[model samples]
Target: MSFASQAREEIARRSTVKACCVRAVCYGIACFAKYFDTKGLVLQTEQQHTAQYAQQMFACCGVEGTVVEKQRPSGILYEFSIREPEQVERMHALFGTTGNETSIQIDPALLRCRGCLSGYIGAAFLCSGTVTDPQKEYNLEFLTPRTNLARDFEALLAEHEFAPRRTRRRAVNVIYIKTSDQVEALLAFMGAEEAAAQIQRQKAVKSVRNRVNRHTNCETANLSKMAKANAQTLLAIRYLQQENALDSLPEPLRQAAAKRLEYPDLSLSALCGCFEPALSKSGLSNRMKKLEAAAAQLKQKREEACNEGDCTEQPAHRG
Candidate 1:
């Protein structure tokens, strides 16, 4: 089966899977109704809206009511009611949805101006700036979401040499364009290159935000190792030492290992929490061991010299 057919089937399967067997069968039956004429479906008055919608679309596009219908091998009925067969070619060139024509009803109350930058202003809202009507009507499903809508709209308006007034209604943004002709021009630009670019920019921004969020989430869980110090961290330690704890150790260690030695008793993993740009636990442990071993060797050498002097002085008298 075709991918779309399979997708539709999958959607149907999911919708029915959670219901009782009888309810599931009812869902399957509903799926089959898609092949028949919209009017033929047994539904409530409000639910019979599709039949009326299809008829309205047929009239708007100047198509006759008569059309061919068929039952498919998959048990779904397919119907075609284009006003003209050439309308199919025109639609494919225009909106890019292939095969059957569907009706889109836009409410003036819900529709917002797309501004001068877009070709879709008459048919759809640009969905940006401050809308005076908080309850403004627009095609919610057809356009991108409202986040950054004003910024996007302004950018598009700048591109088109139109200055749009930004206003807010009920916290929703609306871009006010002065003329209806501009709205028509905006509608005309729908599915055009400039509109596509605007939408593309929106998608790119969304992608960047998503990537940043994912990175932060991963770091919180996985960046547990003690990282090595950068120049800034080393500098911070140097400044801290000049103020206090001056007599704790020799000057060489104070400068070289000052920043990293803050949590001397901690294991590498524990030490990572004490600084910025943390190093791996193993790396921190190794550096600490090397410093400790050197200090131990120096102490041992001093003890050996003192013991030799004592032995040389006492042994001569005993003999």
Candidate 2:
């Protein structure tokens, strides 16, 4: 089932309903229904729970309605109507509607307080609302062709400090909310506590996963940078050995060269850890720099001598 479907089902199946909110809920359903005019009242829905809820509402008010099942590509659809003259008139007067509604509008008189408004809006959502999965994205919206009803709904949301955005999708007015906090709060307000909890839980999981990925990426980059610097240090060490200049160096410099030769895989930072008293990275690094300078001087002199007397390319000294 969709996220919206689950939330709507939860809100619809609420049985311990307040008597006053029952009328508000029914009125919300009527205003957003297929039609609530002089002819009769028609409520079309795909949710069996919604049809049952509506039936329970009317039963409480001593009104009767009928439900007809229609076959559709998706599944069974329900068409509910109350065509009885007295029943239709009673339903309209319950919410202060004129019983000849040409343009649907929210009846402020029906919504006595925040609780009544929440129940009314919840029913209105059951009539024309959908929400995206919180794990994927945060989007909850109501779509209705009635412009006046949509405008009133927007105003209601704003009065309650909900930041709603409005747009037109073809012929319908789309009132959508994109923030997770607002979406979760609204769903909980409408009595879908479990669905709101899912949003909160998934948000925390995503945050932890993102932090782990960033830390792993940082370590990998540091390792890569260390490997490149070590390659240059290795080349200079091999050259000093070939020139037979390794034994002639200062003891600290000789030890630095010895460590690199023994632990060829270690970076300068790791190589520092192998010293008897544990050398600092800069201490080992300065030793390597001085050795490289000595090798460079010998290399320049060797190249000049080869130009004069044809000296041969010598093999690297492994020891």
Candidate 3:
């Protein structure tokens, strides 16, 4: 099952303070309902557990509502509507909704206790929130059609130090938390301990995988540098041999060149071990610099020889 489903199911199975539960269900209906006015009230969701929880909430509040189920292209939809004037009035009083504004505010009574606040946030999530797979990303967002309502929700989270961010996608406003710690904290606050643990496990796995990849890349880069250096040194030694300059070099330089030619794939430190008296990596590097310089001088001389030949072959001034 999806993480969102798991979280909602877990929350639905747990019990909370009666006042907290009433406020939570009220907030959910206000946020997710299709219509919430004196004329009628409608609360809809695709989650069966959420629907069942909503029914239980209404029952606890002594309000009667009709539950309807329908099949849609995406999934099953559960819609709960309270059309009776007396029940609708009771809901308005319970949620403290003004019923004429573009935004809904949390009832102050809901914030009087930490438990109530937790329930409010949890119910809001069950109605409109979605969490990305932790294996892919650390993101949990509540999608709401009303921008002002989303802003209000963001402020509510910020009031509790949740540090949510707000953005608009098409017509909906998204209030999201991106950090894994915050996502885990939110899940825990909502009574989904198992889901929070799952996020932590995924984070640990990702951390280890990233460390391994970085180590492998570092090794690959080092090997590539070693190979390129070895190829250049071999080319330089070959140039000296072709020019009949190898036998004329000091014994140490000649020995170094010979060893390099014999083991073209060895790293500088490894090649140092082949010397009679082991040379430090820096010492071997200095010798390589000398070989490169000698090869450079030879290349310059050949270029000069070619330019002179080209000049001599040209017809003497054609005045």
TM-score of each: 0.24, 0.84, 0.66
C-alpha local distance difference test of each model: 0.37, 0.85, 0.82
- lDDT of each residue in 1-319, candidate 1, tens digit only: 4222222222222211121222222211222222212232221111122233333333333333333344556553334333344643442332233424242221122222332112223112311111111113211111222325445544555466655555666665555554433432332343223333433455577689999999998875554432333333344444445434334656544433664545444444766555456666666555555455555554566578778874222454554
Q: List ranges where model 3 is wrong by over 4 Å.
A: 14-27, 35-41, 57-68, 72-74, 81-104, 132-140, 143-151, 163-188, 192-228, 243-254, 275-279, 286-319
The number of clashing residue pairs in model 1 is 29
> Over the stretch 1-319, how does candidate 3's per-residue lDDT look in tens digits?
9878898899877787567656665566566666766665777888888877877777787777878899999989998788888887777777776566555655566556777777778878888888888877889999888776788889989999798999999988899999999999999988888999999888898899999999999999999998999999999999999988889888878888999999889999999999979999999998988988888897788778878885333466887
TM-score of 1: 0.24
Question: How well does candidate 2 score on lDDT at residue 281?
Answer: 86
Worst 10 residues of 1 by lDDT: 126-135
List model 2 lDDT by residue over 1-319, tens digit each.
Answer: 9888999998887653677787788888887788888867888899988887877777787778888888999899998888999887887677666676578878788888777788888888888888899878899998888999899999989889898888999999999999999999999988888999999898899899999999999989988888777777788889999778889888998899889989988888888899999999888889888878888888998899889876876658856
Candidate 3 C-alpha error for residue 54, in Å:
2.2
Model 1 Cα shift for residue 192 (angstroms) = 14
- Residue 214 lDDT in model 2? 100
Candidate 1 vs candidate 2: the lDDT winner is 2
- Which structure among the candidates has the greatest TM-score? 2
